[model samples]
Target: MITRFEELDWQDTPIGELTLRRRTEPAVGQEIYEVRLGDEYLMSSLFTVAEEELSTLGLAAATGDDLSVLVGGLGLGYTAVTALHDDRVTSLTVVDRLGAVIGWHQRLLLPVSAELVEDPRTSLVEDDFFALVRAAPAEGEGDYSAILLDVDHSPRHQLDPTHADLYTVDGLRSLDRHLATGGVFALWSDDPPDEDFLETMRAVFDGVVAHVIDFANAVTGGTSSNTVYVARSRTAGEPASDRPSKAGS
Candidate 1:
C-alpha cells in the first residue's frame, strides 16, 4: 500500500508547535485533515457536526435581517464557513490567535479553506479573541449581531491559563458588551453541559440555553457529544424575568 499520511505544514508558534496533516483512513478509504498544537489535537475534518451547529444555533437566536457575525476560532474553517451559508450574514469576522492558522486558510491548505476565503464578507483576523472580548466596544455601540466561540476545549478546560477569566461572570459580562442589543453569543465545548457555567452566563445574558449535540464517532463506533451554549445579550430595560435557563439535545 502507498503511504497514506503526510504532514502538509509545520510551524513553531508562541504556544507550541503547530502542524497540519492529511491521512487516508483505511477503514473508510477517505481523506481526513487534522491540525495539532504540539501534542494536542486541535481539530479534525472527520467530525464537525458541533462546530456547524455552533453557527446554526447561535444565529437562530439572533433577530435581525442583516447579521454581522464574529467567530473566535478558525479550526478547519467549518464554523466560519457554516455561518457564510446563511445569506442573511452581511459580514463575518473570524479571529484566531495563531497567525499560522489563518495562513492555512489563505493558502487553501484545507478542504473548506476555499469556501471561507472566497467569500467577500469573510475577514480572517489574527488576534487574541479573549482580549478582544474583554475590551469590547461600549454598550449599544457594538456592531456584531452574533458572536460564536470555540477556542478552548471547554470553559473549565483551556488551552491557556489566560483564557480562564473569560469563562467567569465578569468576563462574560465584558463579552456581553460586544453584542448589539438583541445579539446572541454562542460557545462550543468538548465537555458535557456545564450547569455552573450556564448559571454564570445567565447572570449576564438573557435566555441562556445549553445544547448538547451528538454525533457519530467512527473511531470508537459510538456516539459522542459536545455542548453549545446559546445566549442573548440583555437589552436595556429588559426585565430580569426574561432570563430563562434551559438545556437541549
Candidate 2:
C-alpha cells in the first residue's frame, strides 16, 4: 500500500467543484492539508504565514482592549486560530458560505480544527459573507472590534466574481457600519496592493495600510508574496448615518 496520501472529501457547489485532500509530503516528511476550488488551489497548510498575519495584525489594530472579531473565511483554520492566539480576543465568529468546509472542521479532519471548534469563544456561522456584511445593522452592539477577510483571491480577482462588490466604496461603507467604534478591518489578498482599492478604503475609513508578506514558494523554489490590507474605523465623525454613500460604489 502506498502510504502517501488520500482524498478525504469532495463536493459540488454553486460556483464549482470543491475538494479536500490530505497527503504526505516526502520532501517535508509530514502530512499536508489542501483545499481546492475547481481547477484552482484555494489554500494549503504548508504556507499560512500571510493568513496568520492577517489576524495578528488586524487584531492589533483594533483600539478595543477586549476584542470581538469576525473572520470571513474558514480555510484550514489558520486565520481563526491565529486570532484566538491573542488573549485580548474575547470572542470570534467565523463565517463561510460552504457547509462542507465547516463539516471538515467539525469532524476534526484537519489538525487545527480541534482547537478552533473546542474553544468556547469560537462560533461558526454559515452564510454569504458579502451579503451578511452589507446587510448588517448599520449601528449598535452588533458591531465587531475587528473583521479579518480571507474569502476571495483579492479585490481585483476573486474565487466568486460576486465578491467584487464587497470591495467597492459603497460595500465597504456598509461593512463599516457593522464595525464597533474604533474597529479594525483587515483583508488577506494573494495579490499586491491595488491603488484603486486603497483609494476606495481611504474614502470610507479613517486609515488604511497595505502590508506585503513574503514567503518562499516550495513548488517554484522562489520567493512569493501576499498582501494584507488593514484599515481603521472613523472615530470622530458625525454619525455615519448622515454620511452620503460614495458615488461609483
Candidate 3:
C-alpha cells in the first residue's frame, strides 16, 4: 500500500530556492519532487529514466575491468547511483556546479544517495562541468572509459543559455579530447537532439548513435520521452575529423 504523502510548502525547501515552486509526492515509497520555474518543469528526484539510459549505454561501450568515468551533473545522485551498480567501474568522479544542490543531497536526500556517495568508487567535485572536461587529460591521454553528461535539457532546448556551447562543434571537440581510446561519451537530453548535434558527434568520434527512452510518471501515469547520445572514441588506426561547422547551417 502507498503511504499518505505530504506536500511541503514551496517556501520551506531547497528546491524552492532553486526553482519558483515545488510540490512533492510519494511514488513506490520514494519521494519525488516536481519543481516548476514559471511554466517550465525543471526536474525531479524520482523515476530517472534518462539517467538509467546513460548508465546502461555507457557501461555497454566500456572496455577493461578498471573502467573510469566522469559524470557531468549530480542531480539527485541518480546517474551516480546507477553507475556504481557496475562492479567493473573502478572510479567515478561526479561534477556539479552548485554547492547547494550537493548540500541538499547530503542533508535531505542522503537516505537515498548515501550508498553511492559513500562507496569507495565515488568522488564528488564541485565545479563547472565544462571546466572539468577542459582541464582533463588530453584525448587518448587518460584512463576514463566513459564521460556521461546530463548538464542541460537538450541540444535544442537548454535549461540555461550558456549550455548551448556543449553541443557545438568546438565543444564536442574539446570533450573528445578527454576520452580514452574506444571510450564512449554519453549525453542525456529531455528531447531528441537536432541533426546538427548528431553530425557534430560524427565529426569528432568514430561511432555515434542515439538511444530513446520513454519515462512514465509512476503516480500520474503520464509518459514522456528523452534521448541519449552515445559516441565512441576513434580506434588507434582511424582518422578523426577536425572541421567545424555552423550550428544547423
Among all candidates shown, the one with the greatest lDDT: 1
Of 1 and 2, the candidate ahead on lDDT is: 1
lDDT of 3 by residue, 1-249 (tens): 454444432333322345422334544565455544445566676657778878988788788898898998886677888888889999998888777557655655433467776788888888888865656565554557999998777887776666677678787777877878888998887776567788878877765777777778777778777888887888877786454322210
Off by more than 4 A, model 2: 1-3, 138-141, 238-249
How well is each residue in 194-248 modelled by candidate 1, as lDDT tens digits?
Answer: 9899888888888888999999988788999999999988788876445367777
| lDDT string, candidate 2, 1-249, tens digits | 244768899999887899999998765667899898888889999899999999988988887568899999898999999999999899999999999999999999998999999999999998898888878674454579999999888998888888888889999988998888778999999888887788888878865788889898776778888999988888865433344323120
| Candidate 3 all-Cα RMSD | 5.2
Strongest candidate by TM-score? 1
Clashes of 2: 0
For every model shown, the clashing-pair count is: 0, 0, 1
In the order shown, what is each candidate's alpha-carbon RMSD? 1.7, 4.6, 5.2
List the candidate numbers ranked by TM-score, top first.
Answer: 1, 2, 3
Distance from true location, Cα of 245 in model 2, Å: 22
Global lDDT of each candidate: 0.91, 0.86, 0.72
lDDT of 1: 0.91
Q: Return the TM-score for candidate 2, rounded to 2 decimals.
A: 0.91
